[model samples]
Target: MDALSRAGPRARRAAAAPGPGPSPLPWGRFAAWIDCVCVVTFDLELGQAMELVYPHDFRLTEKEKTSICYLSFPDSYSGGLGDTQFSFRLRQSGGPRTSPFQDDGRYNREAPLTLQREAAHYFGYVYFRQVKDSSMRRGYFQKSLVLVSRLPYVNLFQSLLQLIAPEYFDKLEPCLEAVCNEIDQWPPPVPGQTLNLPVMGVVIQVRIPSRVDKPGSSPVKQFNQENLLPAPLVLPSVHELDLFRCFQPVLIHIQMLWELMLLGEPMVVMAPSPTVSSEMVLALTSVLAPLRYCCDFRPYFTIHDSEFKEYTTRTQAPPNIVVGVTNPFFIKTLQHWPHILRVGELRMSGDLPKQVKVKKLAKLKTLDTKPGIYTSYKTFLHKDKSLIKRLLKGIQRKRPSEVQSALLRRHLLELTQSFIIPLEHYIASLMPLQRAITPWKNPPQIRPFCQEDFMKTLEHAGPQLTCVLKGDWLGLYRRFFKSPNFDGWFRQRHREMTHKLEALHLEAICEADIVAWMKDKSEVEIVDLVLKLREKLVRARCQHVPVREETLQRVGLYIDTIIGSLPEDLQAVLHHP
Candidate 1:
């Protein structure tokens, strides 16, 4: 019976359902004939399947043939039924077949039948025979089917014929054999080898499809064919497709390896010789390009023996993985052992504050003198030192190359010359005056700076005052100063402090109260006060100021006025130089 008719009650139920269902025949019959039938279905396109099975040697007997079939018979029946067995085959039946016998088969002594519907129009057959004398009455069926459809095969063949003459197959055979031989000759990866290098030749094979159809003519015709005359039908073998498939896993593995390289771990690549091909270098660069902007220390690639030694000896270095490529051409050109490595360097110079002081500034009248000036200098010095220390520590932790170390050192030196040295000099200039100034606890009976006390005070300030002369008045100096502009920076600071000192000195000299006190004093006392005033002016002048001659003359005239009012003898004595 045909598959749909044999489906019986199950087929009617399936047909009544709303959507497509499993073929009723296959589902029901699978259980009855499960022991004997092994049905294999090929999901491949019909033309491809036929090409694989029939190839060029075998030709179809007829163009109208639509199906290929297979059949098998059971050797024995179960339950001592005396060798009664069932058989079945698939054929191109035009319409459904049915039996006139009753469903139970008791009246006609007929065999049991089952059908499995496959693709839309195909069906698999199973037949069963009852064991006449056995206690178990169920029949056994054995069947095998190989069905090849005609539509797709005919279409594919017709297209092929239009594209090229049949003689193409004869010319293609040797090329196919050559490709298969090449694939067979490729060495399998070494067992347990940590680095499996890619074979460039195999990689080249995958490019065949793209290169197949060139501009003027096809690539197939270019292949060496010495004895046979060239013809358009003589195409290159399809075995190249197989070779491409064989290399697919290697390509995938290489891609994965590229991802791992992005982790920025240290890597060592072993080459069979001292130098690598330009192609290999290009490949390596492409793999590493993703990490070009990374801020961390870059992975190293080098061919130098010393570098390899350094990498091995440095315990603090990142773990190194060995990389190798399978191409013997590359291998022979690369270094043998302790291979070349490439190391990456930091690309970003970290952002640093333009001003050294990170902290907020306190309000102050002037940085020209006293504690305000001294404190500002000290604060900036400490901030710069801290910044330098932090940067150095980061460099050490990152383990930068020697070139990077030198660059950082140069930067630090520039910072010192620009900001630190001038600050130190300014602080030194202010220290003595800062220490000498003291507040009085009680009013003194006599002026604090008479000639006697004045010389003593001057003696106390002498050593520190000398320091001003010894230091660079033009500004702080360096042996090999790169910044001539630093001289201007220093001079501007000194000029501000000198101006403050000049103002203070002039104010004391012009004080009305100081003149009144001089008038009341004895000639000797007046002379002594004048000397003290002169000493204060000298101190101010020493601080890089050009003390005004007019101011000095004015102070002398006031002392002369006091002397003019004194007795001639006293005046003469006071005028004694």
Candidate 2:
């Protein structure tokens, strides 16, 4: 499912698109919080600040909702509706919202609770009942007329006040002056407007609607939200809200109402098929772009309910999506690409105003095929079981469910975030090891030498140890003596590696070994050779000093136990027959 859409209701119960990520937001949070809470309880720190996360016994009760009064300004008595309403009363039942959207609950009254009391500090957060279940979302939410005790918040106050109660504007001047003058801020307040709060910054805006910024009296404005005037909020596929719709005024403001999850970066599509919905593709593209990620399916693409979320939560790949065969095979932008699975799907049962609904959406059948679905799918499975095994290897290595789809784009999934940083860190780690161990491949660019470097290093080391530097480096002298059979195996493998590396060498022979032969090495060559030597020696040394039958017997005795000591993932390889 798309990350934005994952915030909706139905996506909760639906299994994630086959092997993509976890369930939608609430579920994902619930799972994580479960583990967190378990630890808190175990540690007897339930009173810790973090323990307030969805704890039990503290949610709303239904009776409290029936007697409360909701706030809404009419043309008769108001120019703008401010945050404080001096009104109260009403009651109803208690329940949690199925989705993460604001204002989802069974309540009869709009809680007139003060931001000062329930949540005092300007930015201090509190999850109090606005009614029974109404509140804001994960992203930045800004109201123009939210009353503030501080002067700096005055212009903001007027802007949103107008949105809530336009008729009350004449009264807004004194409020704006009192506050703005105190802060010595702004060119005063404007009427009939909503503020654009892209990432928490706010600005005063006029009621007129325009897509581009037209310069307001205020100097600061949120990115993508500048010049946006107050208007009926528009979203895409309300269930899969087009979160960007609010900023895309006049372009068919939509509430997507569709669950379209994106990874961290924009997915650069490589497939040939393109029958998928352009809007869906655009939506997913938008999500993945800013987040920096990629995808497997196309737009309006249905993914297995179970597999859907795997794409968003940075989870492991589903068996089929990774292998290139989707269910219905809806041809997409880049082959039968994996789509932002519908992590959520919802249909309203109670009466709802038409102002909130749009009729352009539809449910999609998964384009990825399932087991026993077709010949190609089975063929794909058979051919890539090893690939699947490899793909799953990491997941198994750590927590099987640790794989995360992303809240951003696939490329920028938080799991993959430090990609460059980790690579840099890894390179840095290897620098010292390479300098100390490798006297041949210097300034090691291990990437290019991945395959052939070690083989050559081993081959060179063998000849030097056994044939050339047969002194202190000599096996027998240095306690390197081994069983004949083990020696033969080691020698043979070394020779093969040496031959392959020699064949792969693009330049002059890197034969100048620091131990036996020197002065013929490049920084690159030295680094490469050292890394190769380290791999063989360290792994071998860590486990066995001599490659003899006795060693195997002793080591093999602890094989299962040793592998078990390793991660569940790596154990798979050790356990494999």
Q: Cα miss at 416, model 2 (Å)?
A: 4.0
Regions of candidate 2 where Cα sits further than 4 Å from its true position: 1-279, 282-346, 349-415, 418-424, 427-577
Q: Give the TM-score of candidate 1.
A: 0.18
User: Which portions of model 1 miss their true places by more than 4 Å?
Assistant: 1-414, 417-503, 519-522, 534-544
The digit string of per-residue lDDT tens for model 1 on 1-577 reads 7776676443443543332333233222112111111222222233111122211222233211223211111211123322121111122344443221112321111110011111122222212122242332233222222212211111121222232212222344443333322222222211111111112122211112221122112243233234324322332321111111111112212322332333333333322211121112223323332112121121112222123344344355433333322223322333222223221111223532121111112322222211111011211112234434544455456633333333333333343233334343443444224223221111112112122332344334432343322222222222212232334334544555556545445555555455556555676666666566556556655543445667666666766676677788876776785
Model 1, residue 8: C-alpha shift (Å): 99
lDDT of 1 at 66: 24
Worst 10-residue lDDT window, candidate 2: 33-42
TM-scores, one per candidate: 0.18, 0.18
How well is each residue in 256-308 modelled by candidate 2, as lDDT tens digits?
21112211212221112111122233344333221222223222222332333
